[model samples]
Target: MNDQMKVRFFKEARSEENFVEEMCNFRCQVRSDLEERSRLMSEIARRAPDEAGARYLDTLIDRQKRDEHKLVLLKELLFLARVETHERKLDKLDDN
Candidate 1:
């Protein structure tokens, strides 16, 4: 939730065809984050349950897994949208 590693939705292009590029960058960042979270979750899960008792760690791990799933879906959708955007531009040129 902090300024660090926040995802931004570009409602409009940043003046050119860079919006797709921006989305790609966002997807990459999200992918990296997902990998790191999974790794950390794995490391934590390796510990004995008694050590991480009270269910706090379990709750956090579950939340991270859910977040990782969401990011995977989001990145796929972004890629699809970018492809469609490119195809539209090509179609416009064909129509002209």
Candidate 2:
């Protein structure tokens, strides 16, 4: 979301194929993040079970779940972006 990143995305979006590739890369990144977060959460849960610790864990898990939900939503958006690329390709082929 910085200006430079925004410009890079704009350039990528200019090419349907490149845009799809970029979206795939982004999706992979989000998936990796979710996996790492899950691992850390598991470790935290295992190490902490005192009354105070449980409260902290509950709060952390709630925030983590929200983040996970956003990542899943992002994956869906990426899928939709790729679908547009496929549709455009099909339209070109049909014209040919």
State TM-scores per candidate: 0.59, 0.63
Quick one: RMSD of model 1? Answer: 4.4
Off by over 4 Å in 2: 1-12, 50-56
Candidate 1 residues lying further than 4 Å off, grouped into runs, are: 1-16, 51-54
- Mind giving the per-residue lDDT tens digits that candidate 2 earns over 1-96? 235445655678788777778867776775777688677768877887678777877876786776677666656756777788889889999999
Q: 26 in model 2: Cα distance from truth in Å?
A: 1.8
Q: After superposition, how far is residue 3 of candidate 1 from its true place, in Å?
A: 18
User: All models: lDDT?
Assistant: 0.64, 0.72
Report RMSD (Å) for each prediction in the order shown: 4.4, 4.1
Global CA lDDT of candidate 2, please?
Answer: 0.72
- Tell me, by lDDT, which candidate is best: 2
